[model samples]
Target: MCGRADDHFGPLGWQVLNGLFGYQGWELESMRDEVRPTDPIRFVRRTGAGFEAPFGRWGLVPPRMTLDEARKFATFNARIESLHEKPMFRAAFQAQRCVIPIAGFWEWPTSAGVKTKVRITRKDSKPLLVAGLWNCSQTPDGPLESCTIVTRPPTPDLIDVHDRMPALLLSRDIDAWLDAPPIRAREVALASWQPRILQVTPA
Candidate 1:
């Protein structure tokens, strides 16, 4: 499971978004090097008019789950295999799918009690638009919006780094992955998702 991400794309992040989603506006800046759960991260959402980049919390906090309750349990990464079965993600999986634009992500490759941190990025060094699910919850203060990255079993090349990786979508598949009916969206993404080899070990 991925718990941290790096979105230091700076001005280039908008360019990537424009290229992928044809979004013409900008309301976000470069995020911190490590964006953790509950942090406001930039993501793309489809509106009735079109798509736009907006800031959303990195954890999935459904309308029924209080922020306090969600914080106690891990709701950052939704496993693809159990998306429909997971109580925390089922509704969002069906109606609130989104795309998280990221530079790359970090994972703790563990063996026994020992752990090593590694930064994973595509060999091409291009930004990755990761698949995710989002939801909005009403709170006393206001409405709280959050999202979760979708994960699938890792390909053989990435199994050593982690057993699961963020479900990835390519440029051509982004439309269908977002516009298709919820179940079809999942199927489309799973069918077209490509596993990339990452080699950005950062100090």
Candidate 2:
């Protein structure tokens, strides 16, 4: 499960976002070095006109759920295998797909009876675009948007680090992920499981 990540994508990262989605100068709610579940994070979602980047709670809150009830279960990571079968994710999976751009992510790997905190990032150091689903739920304060990262079985390179890894998209695949039909989107998700060079170091 990818429970922690970094969103401090600087100028170059912003350039990449601009190139991919034409993301203009929209401001983030907050940019953190370490973003945890339930914290506000930036994600790009499909809009009628185009794509828009917005801040949303890291844990997904289904439209039918109340904030109190949503807190009762783990909603930060949605398993790819059961997305269509799970009530909490089914609707969003079909319509509210999103991409979460992170500089890198953290994982704890156990070795020799010790757990080591490590950071995993693209070998090229480009931003990692994580596939996810988003939904809006009415809260007492108002409507709140939340998202859950999609996770699948780890690629061979990442198997030693964790049993699962965030489903990632290449820059070219973003359009299909956000605009394609559910069945086609699932194909894109499945195709993303190929191995890629990654840099993992002790954090």
Candidate 3:
């Protein structure tokens, strides 16, 4: 499962986002080098007019869940195969799909009875656009917005590192992944199982 991510995007990252969708008024003042579950992270979600980037908790909390229940829920990642069956993710999968842009992600692989930290990023060195689902739950403090990354079985090259990896979308497929109907979106999720190229090394 994809439990941690890196979000140290600088000027070049903003340039890529601008090239793809023009300027959407995104503020990354709180960006971090290491993002853990339950921490605030930014994700791009489709708005009625276009797309908007907003900070939300990394763990997803279903709209029907109470804050107390949400605290007990572990929803940092959702498995692609069961997106339509899980109560916590079903609604978001149908209409609240999102894209999580990260510089890379970290994984711990066991070797010689020891776990070593490894970082994975695109070989081309561009930001990764990972598929995700988001939802908003009302709370006394205000609306609680959260999101979860979608994971699939690892590709051949990454199977030794982890059994599951984030579903990463190509830049050209962003629109189809976000605007397509539920069925088409599901197809997009499946198609995004493997990225063009990935570089994995010790962190």
Candidate 4:
């Protein structure tokens, strides 16, 4: 269901605007195809409004992997329930959390090989927070950056299209995940009462 996301939009996807968000080994100047800050059109979700920090394309390559090895697996998805145990994601899962504010995302239903894309947006029409993990891994050239979105089991409405859905944090629950102690992070991620039961609108 969930696949590559085109987050290009306005007013909703900025974490830090007019600046670059770099971590320990993130190569600010040497990224493969870095986007300029002046570009009026780019994908972002406003964190506190007015801040836009462009991100590298989604998909993560753990630093431990070699060039050939990384190609085998790395995409825009991660299972929220197994993050702490998945070899490729555990380290970043514990250390590098991020917020992927979305206008919405796409899911596709495929029969044999043909696919039909469906847009899934929030019923309330507000941006949704998708939990993420980021990493800057060592490559032959140097360190390269990548990220992955966390996912949970699909809700009933979404099950028809895909077996799983991205791990989404409700507007009321964003702070709870980001600020919660480690012991509570897992619990918060799996909360049923928060009800991520979003009303889906066809795009």
Candidate 5:
């Protein structure tokens, strides 16, 4: 599960996401250096009109869940294997797929103690376009949007660090992953979690 990330990209980072995702509508003013579940983070989603940059809570909060209840289950990362079957993620997986812009992510190895932190990033130093699902909820204040990252079994390179890793979309496949039907999106997602060229170090 990706519980933490480095997101201090600022406006320039948003530009990078827009360029990679081919959307000119991401309108976030700033980003945080460290992001956690429930924290507001910028995500890119394709609307009927086109792409929209919306700041959403990192953890998915289904319309049925109250903000407090949403905290009980770990909704930050949804397993790709059960995304379609899980009630909490099914709808979002089918229609609200989005991309999470991340500079890097942190994980703790099973063999390591509680204090261990391993930072992983692309060898090319590009931002990771993580596959995610999102939903909208009606809160007392207003409508709240939240999202969850999709994860698959780890690639050979990352298995020692964690049993699962975020489902990643290649720059070329971003369109299909975000706009294709559910079946096609799954295919694109499976193929996109390829042999990775990663740089991992202790954080």
Candidate 6:
């Protein structure tokens, strides 16, 4: 999330994201996207060729209706099994895919009025690249960005608490998902969550 994350780094969050691969804030001034305090932070994809900045919101708002309609689908997650066909998300699946990196996520379970939250992380506790999709829209207010994290069938360990989990990508798939003009659904899954293993600890 551009503006909605805990990993923010003052005015240089953009620098950190773009330079994450190697530069380490080396290309700080090149990115033109402004930081906003919201979900889905925008950043530049610095490739061997150059940099391309895209504006995608943290939540996806598919095309088809008025500005009022967008609010109905500002969801943070999309079920992976149905991404290719879901009316609200299909367009982005083929055209505007993205990558979201996270150290982990929190899940809450409730039973008999008791609620507990557990934090899940990789065995190594490293960051994961969560696959996502996004879109840019124009309203009377000008342009706005949004996105949705794709979710796959939950691991057996997590299924009891939730039926779905974000479709996470391996580092090897980073180039394809974030840079491909169009990514195949099946291929996306293979490059993404198939081998991911995670652990959940009580929060």
The numbered model that scores best in lDDT is 2
For TM-score, the strongest prediction is 2
For model 6, which pairs clash? 2-41, 40-58, 57-145, 57-146, 57-147, 59-147, 60-147
34-87 per-residue lDDT for model 3 (tens digits): 899999888898777777888899999997888678779789999988998999
Question: In candidate 6, how many Å is residue 163 off?
Answer: 1.2
TM-score of 3: 0.93
Using all chains and alpha carbons, the TM-scores for the candidates as numbered come to: 0.89, 0.94, 0.93, 0.68, 0.88, 0.70
- Which tens-of-lDDT digit does each residue in 91-165 have in candidate 1? 887778888888889998877878888898777666787888888889999988788899887766688888788
The total of clashing pairs for model 4 equals 11
RMSD of each: 2.3, 1.6, 1.7, 7.4, 2.5, 5.8
Query: Against the true structure, candidate 5 has what lDDT?
Result: 0.82
Q: What are the per-model numbers of colliding residue pairs?
A: 0, 0, 0, 11, 0, 7
lDDT tens string, model 2, 102-184? 88999999999999999998887778999999988887899899999999888888999999999988777888888899888
Candidate 5 residue runs with Cα over 4 Å from true position: 10-15, 22-31, 110-115
Better of 1 and 3 by lDDT: 3
Global lDDT of each candidate: 0.80, 0.87, 0.86, 0.57, 0.82, 0.60
Relative to the true structure, candidate 3 has a C-alpha RMSD (angstroms) of 1.7
lDDT of 5 by residue, 40-76 (tens): 8778888775677688999999768898999898999
Rate residue 58 of model 6 by lDDT.
59
Sort by lDDT, best first: 2, 3, 5, 1, 6, 4
TM-score preference between candidates 4 and 5, better one: 5
Candidate 3 residue-wise lDDT at 71 = 79
Ranking by TM-score: 2, 3, 1, 5, 6, 4
